[model samples]
Target: MSKILVTGANGQLGQCIKELSVSLDPDNTYLFKSSKDLDITNYQQVLAAFTLENFDFCINCAAYTNVDKAESDTQNAVNVNSTGAQNLATACNQTNTTLLHISTDFVFDGTKNSPYIETDKTAALSVYGNTKNVGETEIIKKAPKSYIIRTSWLYSEYGHNFMKTMIRFGSEKDSLSVINDQTGTPTYAKDLAEVLIKIIQNKPIPYGIYHYSNEGTATWFDFAKAIFEITKSTIQLHPIATEAYPLPAKRPKYSVLNSSKIKTALQLEIPAWRDSLKKAINALP
Candidate 1:
């Protein structure tokens, strides 16, 4: 029985993992820790935790996710995303633990017209993206046994996310305008949680960078519309270009990831974005 350590246990993805862990292999023991319990930025704390638990695998779900706020809080973002990642990787390497790190599609500049593959050159456009890219690089350099999985537009029933935001806004507002130009897949956090567990359970672990998101593509407008449709809300929705709505951080125009590598490696079929959205909505209280 392998011991699994999950960081950022209170976050959406980590919470999803905890929820689904009941159905996981009974032989495996899981330890879920939030930032309060284990601060990844402090190398000593990370090393101590690993030393105490003797974990076989560490799933890093901790990240600085505020895309817009990262513009002003660059230092905090870099500290958590880059330095924290390096600390965890170093700890994992020292303890001989395989690290499964979560990454973002924002690492790309979104200039490509085609779906992004794992090998594509990264040119992050936002502070959050740049920091996350640095985190990925740090993990790759520090931890030899690491699986860096980049996902896009993550949302779940738990925590603050786009789906929950839209649901709340749709209920309160008579009408709303959403950006239709930015395109990517909405990855359900529960779906991602399950896949992460499967990777550890499966043999001949594929230790490398890979992409994982619910299949298919949609803009923020399409995503919001789908949410309203699923809830049977009559909120008026308008589609607008990226320029219609501006934020501190610049989002990718097209960040759809090609998940073929992960699918083939795991021999699994991913659920469609719409299907997963429905599941997430139904799961909500």
Candidate 2:
């Protein structure tokens, strides 16, 4: 059985992995570490953990996800997303452990209308994106046996996410405004969790960057509408332009990921955004 070390255990993706571990891959051993338990930004700390445990794989889920806050809190974002990734990659390299790092679609500037392939040029528009892009680069440079999976619009039953926010707002208010200009896919973290586990189970896994998200394209308005529909809420949702609402960080106008490469590599079929959304909503407590 492979011994896996999953960083950022308290995060949504990490929690999803932990939830799935019970029935998905019961034989494997898993060690879940939160940011407090282990900080990836510290090279010595990371190396010490690697040295202590003979980990078969290190799933690095630790990341500073606040997009707007990242603009002002640049150093913290860099320390966690960039330097933290560098430390993890270096330690994973030294320990001969395969690394699976999670990344974002924000790496793209949202200029391209078409779905972004793994080979597309990353022109990050915000500090968060730039740092994450740097993290991907560091992983590639340091770890040979690594898989960087870039996903978009990630949400689930756990944690603070778009879905949960919509649910709360719909309950509290009668009307809500959402951005229609920005387009992407809503990926259920549970679906992503399954894919990650499947990749681990699938022998002779391909080691490189890959894109995984639910099928179909959607704007934020479309996503919110779907959420209200699934939850049977009558909240009047208005579709607004990106310019209508101003934020510290600039978002990609379009960041739809072409998941064909990952599908072909893993021989897997991904679910549609709405289908997975229904599942996620139903799974919510």
Candidate 3:
């Protein structure tokens, strides 16, 4: 039985993995660790933890996800995303553990009109994006057996996310204005967790960068509208350009990822964004 270690256990994707762990391969032993349990930025601590467990695989879900906060809090972002990733990669290499690191779609500047492939040139526009890009680079350089999966617009039942925020606002506010210009696919953390586990269980797949998100593209406005529709809320939803509702961090204009590579490699059928959204909404309390 392969022993697995999961970082950022309290986060959305990690929580989803926790919830689904029981249903996964019973032979595999799973260990979930939060930032309190294991600080990935501290190299010695990370090395000690890996030494103790002798983990076969480490799924890194920990990240500084706040786009706007990253602008002002640049140091913390670098510490967690870049340095932390470097620590994990180093530890994983020493322990001979395969690392499965999560990344973001923000690595790209979103200038391309078509869906982004794995080999596309990256030019991150925000501090969060830049740090995540650095993390990916560090992992590639440090770990020989590593997989960097770049996902977009991740949401789940466990944490603070776009879906939950929209649901709350739909109930509280009479009307809402969401960004229509920015387009990307919303990824369900549960689906992503399943895929991550699948990659671990079904070995011998190409290990490098891969894009994974729910099928189909939608703007933030479309996503909010769909949330209200699924929840049977009558809140007035307005579509506005990014200029009307400015954010501290500049978002990608179009960050839709082309997931054809992962699908072909894994022989997996990814669910549509709307379908997964409905499932997520139904699962919500």
lDDT for each candidate structure: 0.94, 0.96, 0.94
Off by over 4 Å in 2: none
Model 2 Cα lDDT, one tens digit per residue, 52-146: 99999999889999999999999999999999999999999999999999999999999999999999999999999999999999999999999
* Residue 141 displacement in candidate 1 (angstroms): 0.6
TM of each candidate vs. truth: 0.99, 0.99, 0.99
Q: Which segments of model 1 are wrong by more than 4 Å?
A: none
lDDT of 1 at 173: 95
Cα RMSD (Å) between model 3 and the true structure? 0.6
Candidate 1 has an lDDT of 0.94
**TM-score of candidate 3 to 2 decimals:** 0.99
lDDT of 1 by residue, 115-221 (tens): 99999999999999999999999999999999999999999999999999999998899999999999999999999999998998889556899999999999999
Better of 2 and 3 by lDDT: 2
